[model samples]
Target: MCSFKKVSPITSTGSLLCTSWKQITSTEVPAVSVIANNSSCFQRLYAVLEALSGVEPGEDVLRLAHKVQALPNVSFKGIQCYNGWNQHIRKVTDRQAAIDLVVEKTRKALQILKDNAVECNYITGGGTGSYVFMDVDYSNNLDESGALVTDFSQSLYVLSTVQSVVPGNRAILNTGLKGISLDSGVPKIFGHRDLTFSNGGDEHGIVRPSGNLKVGDQVWLIPGHCDPTVNMHNWIVGVGDQVWLIPGHCDPTVNMHNWIVGVRGGIVECLWPITGRGPGV
Candidate 1:
């Protein structure tokens, strides 16, 4: 919050060449933007998080913080990475190639900050489909030789009772777009390794089974993405008193909930209210 007055002339290249400056104020004050319809409310806000989609060049990305810092009373807090999420489904035959691409892009972005003398101490990013590669908190999980240590994919279960079973290894279920998200991909059928799923409509899920499925039989589905599916519900109920759930993209899903309920041993345990549940005004 220190203020300084210019005491040097600008260089011919249009860059600041201040070798000496006078301190005008030593008092600290929170930064705020005066514009409307923007995230300028400093009372309830601490920082701003901008999305880095990896689409822009690294040098261009560095200009984001430079521009913000050049403003009158606004500060750039940090950035959120989304390269993993957007590049998860790229048509790369080699799995390592995909991982390498994400790693390279992120390294370039960090290098931009290093070259620009901007201190990026805070950062956040990831989604269910892409967190495993970016996350460092492995906790107790580990893979062979500890090469892979953590799993961050969403594990929500979608159980649908079969309503109709037809020939040609095809069946219809009770779950559809109204209860799940299909943007990332179709859901995988649990316990049926050879089954595939597709969106039937708003109220139905089309399933192709490698084996037989009868009417009234329960079929479990693993959503390709978990966030938007949960946002489509008012309450998430659990059977057998258990549910292992995670959101694919937490930001939008969190904005859709007014309450989050927790249960244990088939009994209601707690209810937490969501104070921020809408697109910002």
Candidate 2:
């Protein structure tokens, strides 16, 4: 759900030197101590530092370790998004508001290092999502060409199957009679059902309808909405949290790259490629 909303078609080959900036600024959250693990953990610690800070990896692992060991001049900001909390605004309206909000937060983040009396490097986790929201993209004062800049945390999932036919006098889903409460409108997808039941009661959800469902055919149910029907529970009999990982995050987090699904020694599973994503059928 989150990933699809952010897919941009990168048509421009030239630099995305955005002239506009966000006017909004963020309230600072107290910083936490991000302890460095060890030299081996960051085998190329200097390399990662270079990537985040835009500084040369002038020293080898040993040299960098020694430098930090003797005189630690930098503090670590876990350049990952999940590592931070999402910024809250009524909602971003104008570009200047977005720019100011973003820049203020970035400067607040730099304050963490500034308070520590240490210089810093921002190891940002970049992806398609960052182009729109990251601090580097929103700050107005910074040169389009720069050495270092910062941004604050960013925020940013789904479920299930229900069939609904469309173009009715009032938009409604077939799940109406299938233990579904229309807290939101019926889904809009054409062929599949993205309905949510009180629970994942069974694999197939029988459509309860006002005699609107067609025979020998099906409607694809795309999730018209996401309600917190289930988040506190541990597992769903056999398949609990596994279902949540399928949809993905709302705004991509810099910290998270890939997910590690801890399936308890279970059944053989095949990951179906989402429609139109790849050549696989």
Global lDDT of each model?
Answer: 0.45, 0.28
Give lDDT for model 1.
Answer: 0.45
Query: Residue 249 deviation, candidate 1, in Å?
Result: 9.6
Residues 44-124 of candidate 1 have per-residue lDDT tens digits of: 333332322222648756765675567533455555554444334333344346656766776788788888888776555
Deviating ranges (above 4 Å) for candidate 1? 1-55, 86-96, 102-116, 123-155, 164-171, 194-196, 211-281
Global Cα lDDT for candidate 2: 0.28
**Highest TM-score against the true fold, candidate:** 1
The digit string of per-residue lDDT tens for model 2 on 1-281 reads 00011123334422211211111122111011111222222332322232121221222222322334342323333232221222222223343365455455555655554565544444343224343323312222232244223343221112333232232211222222232222222221222233222222322222222345543333222222232232233221121111221112232221222332222224323333233332221
Error of 1 at 280 (Å): 9.3
